[model samples]
Target: MHRSPTAEAEVAEELAEARPDLVSRYAAELPGARAAVLTRLWRALAYEPLPWVAARVTDGDGLSLRLVDGRRLDGPPADPYATAAYVTDVRLDGRTYDDPARLMTDLGVPHSSDLAAELGHSVASLALSRAGQPTVPPKEGPGADWEWEQRVVDGHPFHPNCRSRPGFSVTEQLAYGPEHRPLVGLRTVPVPAAECLVSGGWPEGMRDGERLLIPVHPWQAAHVLKRVGDEGPVAHPLMSLRTLALSGEGPHVKTALSARLTSSVRDISVYSIGVSATLSAFAESLASRTDGLLHFTRTLGAVTADSPDLAAVLRESPQTYAGSGERVVPVAALATTDLPSSAAWLAEFTRLALTVGLRLLDLGVALEAHGQNLLVVLSATGAPLRLVYRD
Candidate 1:
């Protein structure tokens, strides 16, 4: 989140190119059209191991990464953006123990920290021990080791997602001190489905004021919405509506997108808005020119359905001219043709974006190049052809 778009996208593209196998694995998540473009965009990118790669231990897990020319990445699968973890060593809080034995008594459960964090006003319980508690055996693990515990507790460190995993649901603070504002856990639906932000609202004295939609990064929202309206896939891949708000790994796409955006080397521009708002804004942005939004959309749809070569150009231009803040559905998962080598796929991807004036290749941009983001539909010949992009 802290890195610039150029830096973020560049990093993502690098990762994508480095791990084509991952990208290929998640190709089904995207639609056919976007799969074409992103497949090419990602495949076109050159891969180079920035001098060296490294590894290390973060929290309780292992992390590995490379020291690319940009962001100072510590190796060994480390999250490059973990620097923005909600909890770090800086949050102010204190722990006191009246009886170390009582504190020492195991809570008798897995994920003790989570239990500790929520039991009897969780966090405050740490200070609940009677002044001086007996010394309980310190929790031992790569992350819960003696050194980390002593430093964090005595140092008053704030932990970020200590018990959370990547793409996990995040807990957002309820505003208005939960007085005028209602509190609800942000949820993520495995498959996109219709769900209200708050569950069973307005009970007696409580009144529901608002409902939030899927929580995604500012740049990603517009692009995904555009994909929803893109041609093909009359019924969503699942055919069932599954919507996941930014919660847990289910909806927390921010960091993943962060990795993608930070991985590209292009001019990224994003105007945050709802699905309708994005549509209207994009429409207006192109209204004054010879190419209206509808015309562009139809052109993409038509070319993709009929001519493979034309579809490639239609896909390419909009991505380029529209700017790399990556429009909705930048990548599709379906294969539209039976072609070999990156040339054919790249051509197909480029043609489709051209219709909308999104030149992803010309500008040297790669969006959602991750395995799960790019979808490649196969042709009769058993080769990937059509491309698509989705959440």
Candidate 2:
């Protein structure tokens, strides 16, 4: 059931009494939050390959889909790739459903209740992101590479949990969400050298008195690792919130963040820790055959407390490829910026991405070359220079 505006204010007031800080934020976030939920629900209805969607077609004004129960659903034209907002309500069998959660409940689909809760959280998170000042990078101005990555205010293009952060609090999201552009103070834990399984080369600076100091994400340190020591290094959070650029240079530290962000909970697997170095070396060898168009960020080091919940991987930042006056932008964020929407530029970027992706596949590695994992090194004038692939 959708909460009325008065009901929403009452709830906010109740929360504000305990938090105090939430009073202003709650009011500021509500409108954006509702719109986010509507967008997510619309995405799920339009796409998602649901069994209930018997057939789908498009018309002049919008889209039309037939349900298994012979109910007709209609809405505005859906552009899954575009981040622009869409109408919040859709007509279901000539009846309008104002909220997506209510629509799902009426549809009686499996896992409807659970999904409704997740959708609610997604709305709240999106509202928080939209309420804050968006961090956009200048077209050709001097800015850190991370700043460009952080400019992706919208979360995912198609998934319903685009901005869903189920386990993160509002304060945590403001401090660590990549869109917030927060410089996180990473803490390190001293694990006995023999007790830790390591891959690749651990930095000498991470060692102290016969112990290997393993970096932990602050969130993980508080909720998962729970053995945080001194504040080790300051880092900027990347598009992937789990990974942080050590001062936007050198290597990125991917720490375990045990929460449902976007679609799923991301944690460093024990298996990945075991083979990080080998995989990095293998990827490097394959990248050499791409004729310098591809650069695989090497896994500099990986350490685990013999637990998937407590792990860290030090990865080379993709910024290494960009020379002076060149810019490295994540493909997802690039879509948000003005990158000269010319046929030549699009064709060039497509060719470069496909060439590198296919080359690696021929060499026995299939890259998950989605927008998030794929990046482009662009010339000052927006010419596609090279491709950077990361997991």
Candidate 3:
């Protein structure tokens, strides 16, 4: 999947021709990548629920898990709250296995080869991200909100394929990936209002008489939409590459990006488009009861052409909550920022987050309040004031 359609044939031909030691180099890179993925997988096997896991034993060093096949896997203790974990070698049935593929082979599990290949991809992707790290260190302070997003090289704390992006060549990764901090140019297609299903009230500015403007990611336009025209305005790429924020200040646009990012291929479903306005209203009403401690962005508009791959959702940017000088930072990027990490600051943030999240859940709407979906409005002195939750 790393090769796009244009380069797929070239790569296949290169593989067929044994000119250099490309195969040997790839073989050399496999062990390190596999080890990194296996460490995360082992942590999941130890902490998360897996039917094949027969039992678990905890000790000072780490956790030991017994699989259904009577084989044992041991790794360092898992700290779910921690972002980056130091996972090196895993012990499997008294044998130390650094390569995930080898360990999976020893386990004799079904679909082991497929899973191993995925792990390899993850490992390779992580290495590329590391290599692309900013040569010059970032400025002393949290210079910009987008910088925080770019600093998140190590993605998900637990998932093995956290950085895995199939079908994205190295060049594409540099150009479009949020970690690379590239300003991606969106493509716009104006669809007549009569031809598109409109919900949540399409913004008047984006509407031209009876026609509505729909923005599409360039990759989506080329690969999935199968049509490209009108180079739209550029925008800053957020942690979620599919979402973009216009320059100066405006709404955050969620475009339908047709690609596998991490685990799921992100596509704007027709179901979401149909209920966007109603859901936004319901969410705002629920959030209003929280006494300003929480804010859920209003869905400004949603438009779709009766297709899953072609849709866009516009919502209020989280920056709206911050006052003149206050800053709103994504929770996921907090670890990479220079914001105050003192105990008191952390406790206040925890209280603010829990109060808002639990209250929303109590109100019958549970938000997927992960790092990307959550943002904190910090005072000039770096105090947590309020929380923002967005889809």
Candidate 4:
């Protein structure tokens, strides 16, 4: 039996036709990308509470997993936080497997095939993302905050499906992916005010008389909505692909994108829209007790056409919290800078983050301080200053 083409092969075929110039570069990036994804998968197997992983054994040879099916999966010791592509391959039942998708397929666990497909896409898309990055890392900080977001080419550091944009074609990935740094033109769907549930103050620029102009992601407009409106703001895509940063220090616009990205389909539900204002106010009040150590970007507005498929949320940019000579950077983009390598700096950042986090928790609030939602304000000397959290 002949096996189907892997996602990398499929992407290569697409690039060969649409952009032959990128074919060689994409191919060159595959080995590193594969190892990067394999490292994440190994981490998951070593630590995640998966039912099939019967037991974990560690010996002088490194880490080993005994599956419920009585097969052994072996690899190097997993470091959950390490970003380097240290994992080249792993042994599954005496057979060596380099590709994560292939290894998962041969493992033959329940739902492994579905995971295998996503892993394939993840490797391919990750390579494509790497191929588009600049050859040398930037020596200085970016002119705008959104540029720091684009620097995170590898997406989620721990997820195996970090770059698995299943519905996005190579062309679409290049055109819309934040790593590619494309200018995405947003569209606004007109919905009558009476038919919409709105919270906070909707921008007058987005109001069409009595109708609310809902911002829509181009991908969502084409694939889900099946209707496009007149050209709206041409903005920079942020770390969260559904959200975009408007030009010249404007708010970040979050659109309802109904496609599965990594784990879930990102769509603004009516319940969330209805509670936006209350939640924002509550979060703000909680943040106020932090005494200048923490900040929450306010949700400027939220609206929905009574459907998850058509909703929008406008929020103030986290950069708004940055004073002159300071930089507010998403935690995910910290790898692009040398700050993380400094033990002293990391300690300071840890203390500040824990201080705010513990303070909030003591006051009856637990923040989602994940890489994407959390940011650090760095002084002109690159010292950690404070923390910023947003959804």
Task: Estimate TM-scores for all models.
Answer: 0.22, 0.88, 0.85, 0.97
lDDT of 2 by residue, 1-391 (tens): 2443333443454455544655676677766666666766787678889998899899998989888888888988877765555666778888876565566666777888777666666666665666565345355543877877788877776666777777676667878988878889999988898999999889998999779988888888888766666787999888889888888356888988888787678888888899999988888888889899998888889999898887899887888888999988889887766564777788888888888878777878788887788889989888999998886
Residues 10-82 of candidate 1: C-alpha lDDT, one tens digit per residue: 3234435543433332223112212222122111111223233232224443222322322222212223222
Candidate 4 lDDT by residue in tens digits, 1-391: 1122579999999888877888999999998888999999999899999999999999988899999989999999878778788888899888888899998899888999999999999999999999888788778679899999999999998899999999999999998999999999998889899999999999899989999899999899999999987688989999989999998879999999898898789998999999999999998988888889999999999999999999999999999999999999999999888888999998999999999988888888788798999999999999989988998
**Model 3 lDDT on a 0 to 1 scale:** 0.74
RMSD of 3: 5.1
CA lDDT, every model vs. true structure = 0.23, 0.78, 0.74, 0.90
Which has the better lDDT: candidate 1, or candidate 3?
Answer: 3
The best-first sequence of candidates by lDDT reads 4, 2, 3, 1
Q: Which ranges of candidate 1 are over 4 A from the true structure?
A: 1-46, 49-283, 287-331, 336-352, 358-391
Of the pair 1 and 4, which is ahead by TM-score? 4
Consecutive 10-residue window with the lowest summed lDDT within model 3? 1-10
Candidate 3's C-alpha runs over 4 A off are 1-36, 59-61, 101-108, 140-144, 204-210, 338-340
Winner on lDDT (2 vs 3): 2
Instruction: Please give the TM-score that candidate 4 achieves against the real structure.
Output: 0.97
Lowest summed lDDT across 10 adjacent residues in model 2 is found at 1-10
User: Largest lDDT belongs to which candidate?
Assistant: 4
Identify the superior model by lDDT, candidate 1 or candidate 2.
2
